[model samples]
Structure formats: structure tokens, C-alpha cells
Target chain A: MALLGILLFLMIIGAVIAVETRNLLSSIVCLGAIGFLLSIVFLFLGAPDLAITQLVVEILCLVILIRATIHRRVETVAGNREFVGLAVTVVMLAIVLMLAISMMAGFPSLGTSVLDRMAQAPSHFYLLQGKAQTGVTNIVTAILLDFRAYDTLGEATVLFCAVMGALAVLRRSARRRPEEGDAGDEGEGGAE
Target chain B: MSGGTHQGGMSLIVRTVTRWLKAFILLFGIYVVLYGHVSPGGGFAGGVVIACAYILLTLAEGRERTARLLSERLAAVLAVAGLLFFLGVGLAGMVGGRAFLDNFLVGDSGAEPALASGGIIELCEIAIGIIVSMSLFLAFAVLSRFRVSLGDGDETATGEGGAS
Candidate 1:
């Protein structure tokens, strides 16, 4: 718990620095740091699957974001208005944290043992029979690919559509006129 | 602007390190996907790992080489192929008179914790891994290919090779 608290604190600091930085690259780096910390938190929560996904996703996002800002000039605020924004954000975060703490009072206390909690949940059931039913030792994979495959399918569809749409938007030829296809400068070698 | 006239990649140190590391990273990604049933990483995580390997290549090597290595059309085709493969598995279950995505190879599945244990689940994971890795690589390829109109008659690249 203490470790989690420290990690969360560090994540918060990283996030603040990311938002407040003048350099776009620095902000992206800080964002990556926060993402790594979140993956560590996920690992601590006994979800290595999620941790792996988060870590890789963070790296890809960092690469893409860095590429985005590489050609563009960093947007430098002229004055100390960013400080005011940071102050408001800190105040808002404090209130949300206070509310969250107050709400936690009514629920199960922190650091409760897993056995002491809801044992009759679907997770427990999955843990018990996942291997026998799906023949996979990793219950998470079994559940994702077997019991909840439709969800995975939906996610795949969403990803496919999103990427295609992004490609459409980023296409330089798409912005050009329809007559430009005959020009042939916008073909396969465009990646260069 | 740097590495002018070369258009190769980052510094010599990065390229050297990546040359030695890329193969290991690709191997690790394959291991993660294949052994997902017995390990913490499944299709999604493993696919991202594989895509990261390519992304690493794109970072160390230039966009031109990476694009030539894995063309945009091939990546798109792989993405569609993966989706179809997953759907094919689901339909195969239906042909066996079971519901979609039903594990039909339970009888022939190996030991409980072995790599061959998962009947259709392992195949599904592989399919998903292909979809994710291909699509992500496609996205990066296209993004890196993007060129901004500078209006100065000097329209260089916007990403990967040599960012100004």
C-alpha cells in the first residue's frame, strides 16, 4: 500500500510536469513516465497482462506524439497564465481526492484480503473452471478469447475503423484535388 | 536536418544497438504470443510487443527502409487477414454444431499447462495478435509518411528519418 501510494504520488508529479512544461518533447517524455508508473501500478494490482499492454502502448504513443511535435513549433505561453491553470487543477484534484477518500469510508477498507472479499464473483468462477473449460492456463486469455470473445471482436472492429479513419485524415493526397491522382507523385514512394 | 544526405537514421550508437537488439525483440514478441496461454501476455499485449519491435526499427532505421521492409498494402492485407482468420475460427466452431468461438479441440488438447493445451483459444490469440501488430504498424507507417506543407518550396519529411 505504501508503495502504491508513493507510485501514485510520483505519477501525479509526472503528470503535473507534463502539463506544465514549455517544451513539447519534455511534456511527452513526462507523459511516458506517468504511463510507465501506471503500468507498475497495474503490475502491483496483479494484472501483468494489463501491465504489458500499457507499457507497449505507452511506447507507441510516445513515438507517435514525438513525431507529431517534431516539425511543429512548441506553443509557448507568453505569460504566467499557465500557473493559474495549474493552481486550479491542483485545487480540483484535492477536492476529488477528498471526495474519493470520504467515499472509501463506506466501502471495504483498504488492503483487505482477497479471500475476505467477494468470493462468489464471476472472477472466482472463471479461475476455478477456466482451464478445464478452455484448456488454457492463462485464465485472462481464456476469458478474453472464449467467454467474452464478442467483446474482443468489437474492440478489433473499433480499432480497425479508427486506424482507417486516421489514415484517411493523414493522407496528403486526400487533401489534394481529385485531378492530382494523375500526377502520380502521391503513390507508394510517398513514405520517403 | 541532421544526418543530411544520408537519410539513414538516428546516431551511429542507436543504429548499432538496434541492429543487435531488434532480432531479440522480435523473438520475444513471438514467444509472448505463442506462449500466451501459459503466460501473462496474451494476444493484445503480445501484438503490441511485436508492433513495438517494428516501431523500434522505424526509430533506429529510416522511414524509407522500414516502408520498403513492410509496405502499407501488405500491412493492411495482414490486418484484414487476421480479422478473417479470427472469424474463420468462430465459424469453424459453428460448423461443429457449437456456438461461435467454441473450443472444438478439447479432446486432442495436450497437457493442462502445455503450449498445445488451448484448443481454439490459442489460434484466436494468434489471430488477434496479427491484427493488432499489423494495424499498429500501418498506423505508424502512414503517420510517419505524413508531410506538412511548409510553403517554402523545401517540403522535407515530417517524421522518422530526420525531423527538423
Candidate 2:
């Protein structure tokens, strides 16, 4: 619990640094740090798989963000608009914190459940029958690839759509630039 | 912009490290995907790891080199092939008088966790891994190429015209 609190505090600091930094690269680096910390927290919370996923996803996001920010100017948003945004964010944060604290008061402690026996039966059934039904030792994998295979298929389809959409948008932009006749000169051949 | 022309990526040390680690990363990804039935990682995680290896290569060795290794057209084809393989596996199961994605193989469960244990699940994992890795690599490749094309605006026009 203390470790969790420490992680949460560091996360908040990292988030603030990410938001407030004028350097886009530093902001992305800070964001990656937060993601790494959050993945560690996930591991502590007994979700190693989630931790692994979070780490890899965070790395990929960082790579993409860095790529996008390259060749772009890093401009800081300042003045009255920034102050107003900060004020609104603080207010929202306070409200969220209050609500979360209140909700936590009603929840049971670790290793204890607010849910009744009947409500917990499905998980118990899975723990007992997962291996026999799926011939897989890892219950999580069995559940994901066997019991909930359809959901995974749906997720794959969504991924496919997203990739296709990105390609289509890129292709359209490439096509449009030619007709505009405002083509800039070719620059470097390698990474910038 | 001209700086990129001179030094494509980082100095010698970083590039050397990346080159050495790239193979291990790719191998680990395949291991994760193949052992999904008995391990912590599944197709998605493994695929992302695999994609990261290519991304690392691009970041280190430069886009031109990576493009030569796995071109956009090949990536697109691989993505489609992965999806088709997945669909084919499901259809195969259905054709065997079972439900879609059913485990059709009638072998006894192995004593130890082996590749042949899970009938259709292992195959599905492989398919998913291929789809995810290829799609992600394709997305990154397309985005990077788009950025380059935008940078070299006139070149895109001529290239597109020639291709068409």
C-alpha cells in the first residue's frame, strides 16, 4: 500500500512534467517513465501480463510519438489560456479525488471481497475447469484464447480496421499533395 | 534536415547495441507467440515485441535500410496473409463438423506443455501474432514513409505517377 502511494505520487509528478515541459522530447520521455512506473505497479498488483503489455505498448507509443515530433517545432502554450486550463484541471482533479476516496471507503480490503459467494462462483469455476477444457496450463491464456476467442477475433478486426483507416488517410494525403502543385524540394535521404 | 543526411542515426555505440539486440528481441517475440498456450504472453504482446524489433532497426539503421529489408508492399501482403491464415483455420474447424474455432485435433493432452498440445489455439495464436506484427510494422512504415514523402514533396508526385 505504501509502495502504491509512492508510485501514484511519482506518476502525478511525471504527468505534470510531461504536461508542462516545453521540450517535446523530454515530455515524451517523461511520459514513458510514467508508463514504466505504472507497469511496475501493475506487476505489484499481481498482473504480470498486463505489466508486460503496458511496457511494450508504452515503448511503441513513445517510438511513434518521437517519430511524429521529429522535424516539428516545440512551442509552449503560455499566458491566460494556460492558467485557465490549469485551474479547470485542478478543479476536476479535486472532484475526482473526493469521489474516489468516498468510493474506496465502501470497498473491502485486500484478500477480502464485497462480492457474495454466488458472484464469485464464475471465477472459481474457471480456475478449476480451465485447464481441462482448454488443455492449457495458463488459465489466463486459456480464458483469452479459448473461452473468449470470439472477443479476441473482434479485437483483431478492430485492429485491422484501424490500420486500414490509417493507411487510407495517408494515401489520400499523398494523393492530394501532388494535385496542389506546392511540392517542396527533397531533403535528406536518412533519419533526422 | 541536412544533419539527417550526414548522420542517419545515433553514434556507433548505440547502433552496435541495437544490431546485437535485434535478433534476441525477434527470437523472444516468436517464443512468446509460440508458447502462448503455456506462458504469460499471448499473440498481441509477442507481436508488439516483434514489431518493436523492426522499429528499433529503423530507428538505428535508418529508414532506407529497413525499407529494403521489408518493403511496404511486402508488409501489406503479409498482413493480409496473416488474416487469411486465421480465417482459414476457423473455417477448417467449421468444415470438420465443429463450431468455428473449435479444437478439432483429437490427440491426448500432452504430459508436458508442448507446441502440439492446444489444437487450434496454438495455430490461432500464430495467426494473430503474424497479423499484429505485420500490421503494426506496416502502420509504422507507412507513417514514416508518409513523413518522408511530405518532406520530399515533389518526389512523391513523380513516384506515384510512375507507379500508376
Candidate 3:
């Protein structure tokens, strides 16, 4: 419990630092720290698959963010110029915190879950007959790839959109001919 | 390789280490993908790991070299192919059975916890893995090559040239 609390506290601090830090690199690193800490929390919660996914995704995010930011000039630290936006953020955070705290009352006891409390819980079905139905030992994978395949498909589609968005936004002369490139280079040289 | 605006990669130590480690990382990623049904990691995690292997290589060898290794065109093609294949699998299910993205081809092959088991699950995982890795690599390629221009107001930011 103590360890979990410490981890949660650290994650909150990391979040604050990530948003407040002037240096883009420091903010990125702090965001990465929060992700890693969250992954650890997932591990503690007995979700090893989620932990592994979180860890790898964090690494990938850090790499890409660092790569994109490394060459860019960030002379100015941009802040939220609009006070209304800041106020909205605070209000949203407070609402979310309040909702979370209030929802805790509805949560089951630490050692018990829907599987134990309810007879018709989906988890019970997964735990009992998942292997028999999907023929896979890892029930998580069985659920993801077998039972909830459409969800996986949706996730893939989302990833596809993200990649296409990046490509669309960042594409610059994807099919420039060699001659055109040389001509552009020569033009630049002439201007210089 | 010829026309990009990137310097040579990091130092010799980083390059050499990357050279040795990338292969192992790639293999580990495959292992994770292949054994995903039997293990903690599934296609999504494994594919990211695979992309990371390539990303590491890219980090060490610079964008041009990495582009040569994977290439922007090839990554895009692979991503499309992966999605098509996944859809193909779904259509295959429809031809012989009911429901979209159904596990029609699974079962009747192998038991639990083995490589042979989880029929369509394995296939779907491979497809997802391919899609994820290639798309991620494509995103990285695009992002790395992106140039943010601050000046030259008349040049128009969209068409401002950066050699692809």
C-alpha cells in the first residue's frame, strides 16, 4: 500500500513537472517517467501484459518525441496564454478527481471482484471457458484476439489514422525526381 | 541517402552496439509476437518492440541509412498490406461462416499453450504485428524528416521544400 501510494505520488509530481518544465527535453523525460511509473503500478495490479505494453509504448513515445524535438528550435517556452483555458483545465481536473473519489465508494473490496461477487460476470466466463473456447493459455490474448477482436481491429484502425495523419502533415516532396532535386539545389546555390 | 538534410549518426560505440543489439531485439520481438498467445505480450506489444529495433538502428545510422534499410515507401506498402491481409482474414471467415472477424478457422488444430493452437488468433496477431510495426516505422520516418520552417512567409509553409 505504501509503495503504491509513493508511486502514485511520484506519478502526480511527474505529471506536474512534465507540464510545467521549460525545457522540452525535460518535459518529455518527465512524461516518460510518469509512463514508467504507471507501468509499474500496472504490474502491481497483476496486469503484466499491460505493464509490458506500457513500458514498450513509453520507450517508443520517448524516442519519437525526442527525435522530433531534438532538431527543432525551442527558443521560447510557450504557455497557456488564455486564462479561460487554464481555468477550464483546472475545473476538469477537479471534476475528474471528485468523480474518482466518489466512485471509490462503489468499488468492490480489495480482495474481491465482479467474478467473485456476481455469478454472470464475463470474467468468470473467460476464466472458466476461455481456454476451452479459444484454445489459448493466456486468457488475455484469448480475450483480445478471439472474443474482442473488433476492438483490436478498431485499435489498428486508430493507429492507421495516426500514421496517415503524420504522413499527410509531414510529407514534403515524397516523389521529387532526381533532376528536380538537383535543380532545386542549383537554384538554392545560385540564390546563395 | 543522397539528398536529405541529416548529419552522420552517433559515435562509433553507439553504432557498433546498435549493430549487435538490433538483431537480438528484432528476434525478441518476433518471439513475443509468435508466442504471444502463450505469453504476456500479444501482437501490439511485440510489433512495437520490432519497430523499436528498427528505430534503434535508425538512431545509430541516421535517417538516410535507415530509409535505405526500410524505406518510406516500403513501410507504407507494408502497413497497407498488413491491413489488407487482416481484412482478408475477416472476409475469409465470412465466406465459410457467419460474422465478421470471427474465429472460424480456429480450433480442431491444437490444444492450449502450444504454438499450433489458437488458429485465427495466431494469424490475426501476425497481421496486427505487421500493421503496427510498419505504421510506427512510417510515422517515425515522417516525423524525423519533418522540418519546421519559421521564416520565408511567402514560401507557404505547406510547399516549403524538404528533400524526401
- lDDT digits (tens) for residues A98-185 of candidate 1: 9998998888765664546888878887888887787787888888888888889889878887887877777664344444445457
| Candidate 2 to truth, TM | 0.82
For each candidate in turn, the TM-score is 0.83, 0.82, 0.84
Q: Which stretches of candidate 2 lie over 4 Å from their true place?
A: A82-99, A111-120, A172-192, B1-10, B106-110, B147-164
Better of 2 and 3 by DockQ: 3
Model 1 DockQ class: acceptable
DockQ category of candidate 2: acceptable
Whichever of 2 and 3 has more TM-score, that candidate is 3
Among all windows of ten consecutive residues in candidate 3 chain A, which has the lowest summed lDDT? A183-192
Once fitted onto the true fold, the runs of candidate 3 whose alpha carbons sit more than 4 angstroms away are: A71-92, A173-192, B1-7, B108-112, B147-164
Q: Using alpha carbons, what is the TM-score of model 3?
A: 0.84
> What tens-digit string does per-residue lDDT give for candidate 2 at A1-192?
899989989999999999988777798899999999999999888877788889988999888777756655644545566778899999999999999999999777764643453566677777777777777787777777777777887788788778978888766544454445443532423222
Instruction: Report, for every candidate in turn, its global Cα lDDT versus the true structure.
Output: 0.78, 0.75, 0.79
For candidate 1, give the lDDT: 0.78
Compare the candidates by lDDT and give the number of the best one: 3
Error of 3 at B105 (Å): 2.8
- Model 2 DockQ, alpha carbons vs. true complex: 0.34
Across residues B51-70, which tens digit of lDDT does each residue of candidate 1 receive?
88888887777767777777
Q: Which candidate is the best by TM-score?
A: 3
Measured with DockQ on alpha carbons, how good is candidate 3? 0.41
| Residue range B40-108, candidate 3, lDDT tens digits | 998999999999998887777776677777887888889989888888887777875588878886764
